[model samples]
Target: MEYIVEKIGMSRTITVPSQAVTLLRVLDAKVCEVNEGIAIVSYNSGKKMNKTIEGQQKKYSLSSEFNRFVTLEVANTEAGDLDLTPLADAEVLKTTFTTKGRGFAGVMKRWNFGGGPASHGHRMGRRTGSIGNAEWPGRVMKGKKMPGHYGNIKNSVKNEIVSFDAENNIIAVSGSVSGANGSLGRVKVAK
Candidate 1:
């Protein structure tokens, strides 16, 4: 089963001796519809509900209108039923989320290209030089590293569960997770 989560922040555990962990809060999700092995779920955000969302909530018999809806493929079990309760018991989970946006970046910072010498004679410093050859293939090859936008892309990371607070609906996982604080995340059992 999959769950919609929010990144709380990163912290270090005192007992673990310098072990860093990222905290994730599981948002309240209600199953709206189920078909075959897929389940449609919805969860509310901080924003207030609107009329259109309210109608969808009423149609699904949900307590309130949710800000977002996600479809999750149910993991097969011996009983041939979708078991969502195992999400809390999972020891390791794979999280998918967007990373922090770095905006526009140069080749030196983005691709770690060695910049030109910083001497007075050098006209170009921290610039991508020799993009293409004079002859032979004449054009810049595809997939060549160039200066452009970086980060703010979907990323998935496997994390080990450090601890879980079921009462508080919080989970602590080792290592850094993607996205900034309060960013939406998707968590599932690591395959």
Candidate 2:
């Protein structure tokens, strides 16, 4: 019984493991649709969702009112066994989502390249150094490390235990999860 939720915000003063805690605000997910052995869940507010979301809203009337999309998959049961009465009833198995994206980054930030000197005619600072030979092959080698875009790609992190607060509906995980605050994320269970 896995699902997804949006990172609403961070709790100002929540204690975590090492030192003090950084509470991550995640709303309870809504069970949208169940098919085969999978379930499509989401969290979104009517205000923030676009027109494309509004059209899909009709299919997920049973879900909560939040402005994000999350898909889920169930184990040991088909879609027929899905219970819609208790919307919040679920178990966390895994979370899948894109990480916090750092777009168009250099080798320094992207690959931890030690930049060159800041003064004295060192112009190639922070740039990827020589990639290939001059005339042996006459071209840059394949799979050479270079500056490029970072993050903003599909990622799946699994086997995270869910820590939820029944009173306030706040959910936390054992380790740090990906994506910036308020980014959409998915949670799913193995079938």
Candidate 3:
């Protein structure tokens, strides 16, 4: 099963040897539909819900409508046999989220390409040179690195859970996580 969480920023653990950790806030979720091996869950954000969502929530007998919805699938367990509360006991989790948008970037910043020398007469410094070859393969390679859009892409990272506050709906995980603060994240058991 997957749970919707919000990125709450990064912090350092207070252990003897401090380590970086990412804080995540578990949003309120309600099961909207239950099937054989799939369940539809709705997550509540700070924003107000629209009419369409409100109607769906009413149909499910939920008091409040949610801002986002996620479909969770279990291998062999039916919806009735699943328990969403197990997220608090997860040791290792895989988090999927979008990273911070970097707009248009150059090869140096995007791909860490070694640019040309900055000395005088080197007008092509910091530029991606030799994009093509001779007549044999005149066109550029398919996966050639070039300046273009970077970040804001969906990425998954496996993190070790440092701590969990079930009452407060907060989870602390070791290492960095994708996305900026307040960005949506999906957390699930690491395979």
**Candidate 2 segments exceeding 4 Å error:** 8-33, 40-42, 45-71, 75-92, 159-162
Tell me the spans in candidate 3 whose CA falls farther than 4 Å from its real position: 74-84
> What is the model-wide C-alpha lDDT for candidate 3?
0.81
- The TM-scores of all predictions, comma-separated, are 0.86, 0.67, 0.86
Off by over 4 Å in 1: 48-52, 74-84
Rank by lDDT, highest first. 1, 3, 2
Q: Would you list the C-alpha lDDT of every candidate in the order shown?
A: 0.81, 0.58, 0.81
lDDT tens per residue, model 1, 8-30: 99998989367999999888766
Error of 2 at 18 (Å): 3.3
C-alpha positional error of residue 116 in candidate 3 after TM-score superposition, expressed in Å: 2.1
How many times do residue backbones clash in model 3? Answer: 0
- Per model, how many backbone clashes are there? 0, 8, 0
Candidate 3 per-residue C-alpha lDDT over 1-191 given as tens digits, one digit per residue, 9 for 90 to 100? 67788999999988999999999987777656677857787777667888888777777666663665678753324322235467666799899999899999999999999999898888888898888989967898899999999998999999999988878888899999999899988888773
